[model samples]
Target: MEHANTAQLGRGPVTSSDLRRRQNGRLASIGEPLPIGMRGADAGGREGRSEAPLPLILRRVHPLILLSTVLMCLATGARAQQSSTATYSVTFQGNWTTASTPGGVVGGAHFTTLIGAVHNDQVTFWESGGTATAGVERVAELGSTGTFKSEINANSNAISVIEQSVSGGGTGSATFNVTVTSDHPRVTLLSMIGPSPDWFVGVSGRSLLNTQGNWQSPIQVDLFPYDAGTEDGTEFSLSNPATSPQGVITSIRGTGKFSNVRMARLTFTLQSAIPPPTPPPPPPGGGGFGGGGGAPRTSAPSAPRNLTAVGGDGEVVLTWEPPLRDGGADITDYEYRVDR
Candidate 1:
């Protein structure tokens, strides 16, 4: 349904009379050849058919409508043949030091909570060398995820956005799982490098689709530094007011106080119910179509065992063994939640 223009079509069913009028109007505008068996002396001329008129509904279907229907059918078949889920384990590696030298931008010591999304190509959270949107400006200037979340949530192409805190100064990581269709196969991530003024690191418009038009698995990408251009502060710690004229969102050139630093890493793993294999071809003599495989697998792994929690001076520790049955594939990751 990508690029399908259904905005003009109303939700209610179209009456026979209305459909015919719409079809006639569209055919006149397109001026394309009629479909097979749809052509006749009366097709393009003003003259009417002498014999019984052909089915009105057949002529009413607009070319774009027909194309949309074909695309829908193809999409259905694609869903049956491909995986529809993808999970990404992202790590924030903060290498910037806090100590500012005789003359250098204060090192970006910590990173605020990471916020990101898996969306279609049509939606982009932020762009380089372009004016930063208000949402991006807020995140870069204030280290707040709410604005970014709100902005992307309003976009129709965004499939999912997730937020999790990752302490800076060292490597902190979080995992995000999203259901993805073929039409939406791109991912984006952003996090403010805290104690810095309008500086953040992330990936923009990174695609999950491989060359073969399928979701790529275990895809890895490195993060780059960008200036949001909302604040004029040169050092990590903001002391100055907004610049006279806000700069356009731009890459942090390695030559200046803001260095092009590689700050994080991300890995995306796409998962799906594996389809059954095709049967081998028969000998020269013809044989039956051949029996296909069995039903789809939909079982989940058992939960962890021997879960133990211990409280220390100011921290709680947790440990547990892997699940007894890992369903079918290997247990690649684990998820934990703490309720207030």
Candidate 2:
């Protein structure tokens, strides 16, 4: 014991075997963790002497100490896993019913561009009963999502945003995928109600994590129409003035509200369970230009068919069917003449 204490204090040179005994005694006396890589013979302080095996030395450690060390490692690993980013597959389906309001206002249900973001609980794009932000006004009044996306991107906790054109009278859909972490587990979405002035539908601050802090799969949420409160026009028209004091954002109600109508549906799926989209297979004979036999040539495309038009507020929408014969080439552009 005297020699062990003296050797540990470095008062005398000792063999690997002697150092190993002293090292154990020192740890027992001080209750301190061993210095990383510090060992008897393996430490190489002395010459020609073998050191004690690490496994043998560990066996001598207190059971409680070993248990605590293992627990610490596991806790660290769990935290790392919890903070890792996860991918979410999100889809938005437009389900608005087309019709006119009692006030003689057009309510043809066609969605504008879909705009949304994965954000933290603290971030907000628009809230019921709150004043509409400029970003919201842009989408509501003009069906633009550029400003809305910028607003969300400025937020520190925003994870991702999606803005794509999606419109329908009763059924339409758009899909996007985003990566999120535990810190940003909520999603918000918005789309303008076309043919309506300052009206839109969306979901806000929808959480992806469950009560147990686990990611939930296949979250389905219904959407409803809400007035942006930026314009006073009662009908879907471009001719309107900005409300003096933008009214409080509110759910669509009253004779103007499409109460009986469903506007849209949002679905959130977990990527872990479902794979994402993949590129389409190559064309029958290799793809891209300068390849085998150029794309099959077809007869000249027939003229556009079923041409129809509708006049609204200050703009007109035209609808038509594709040409019957594409002239062996895909139709790349359209030319339409508007006669006043």
Candidate 3:
């Protein structure tokens, strides 16, 4: 019953076969309008009885009414659109032995947070051990996140933490932010690299386009380095200078010298989704190849919730239910479509 179309004929209260199947849901009701058998010629086309407008007879033959009036003018310009998003923030600065020894990256003396394990866009708190499962073993043993922000707020999701530990480090390090309202559309970030237990830092599951209202996207990245099987890097802790680094390592499997721990380049960006222009679809079978959406769409995707295409019939597939930000798991990927 919700399938209202035919370009919503005359605007409302439909019944001319519901505006001819909202314009053409695949017409199949032959025989009705060609009953002008005796209107004894009037006004120009010459008719007289004047029963108003009751002359029809076009059930099909014209390309199924031009493909059901182009899938109801592409499902009425997709219900007059209304799904735009934007929200952002990113920062992870800490670990300094002389101010991080000019960016060699090293930490551990105590500066805990774990930030309740990310909040928005589905709590994702780092994974690369078993790869991940709620930042297991405090992100691979003692790298510390205090139970991974307590499992992203016990799975209800939404976490925030700020600690300066008596303000000697001057309230710095750990500032991951992302706040774009108006229906929300994408975000995700995480971190872990203390005393190098699991060695983690990640970002995934993103899509924040609005530009002017603000969501933005412009990413350039390079990341790879992990080895947190969970405590076995054999250390003594307190041999001479409170030692904990003899051979310095517990488990690195077949150890290729900590299997190539190198790669960290950066650049990031992603933004676009503006909603407002709806109600404009009465030109399908008559004329229209493209007009709105501002830009993006060569036809094929079908969007708004209807996936499983595997790149066949014009391609279009989507999937969800596995993304956790703030606490961080680093979602990986999921954008479905944003085409025009």
Q: Please name the candidate that would achieve the greatest lDDT relative to the true structure.
A: 2
Compose the digit string of candidate 2's lDDT tens values, residues 158-190: 878866677445466878786766777787888
Stretches of candidate 3 above 4 Å error? 1-82, 90-171, 174-186, 199-231, 234-281, 284-340
lDDT string, candidate 1, 1-340, tens digits? 0111111222333222232212333332123454422222222222211111122222333334433321110000000133355444444455453222224434446667777777887876788877787888778877788888998898898877867787635355666565556666676777876666788878787887788876677677866668888888766675557755878877774634544545566666665523235534433432221111122223455665665434333322344555676544344333222111
What global local distance difference test value does model 3 have? 0.32
Q: Clash totals for all models, in order?
A: 0, 8, 52
Query: Rank order by lDDT, top first?
Result: 2, 1, 3
Top-TM-score structure, candidate number: 1
- lDDT of residue 92 for candidate 2: 81
For candidate 2, which ten residues in a row score worst on lDDT?
A: 71-80
Clashing pairs in 2: 195-236, 298-328, 299-327, 300-327, 301-325, 301-326, 301-327, 302-325
Write down the lDDT of every candidate, Cα atoms only.
0.53, 0.57, 0.32
TM-score of 1: 0.54
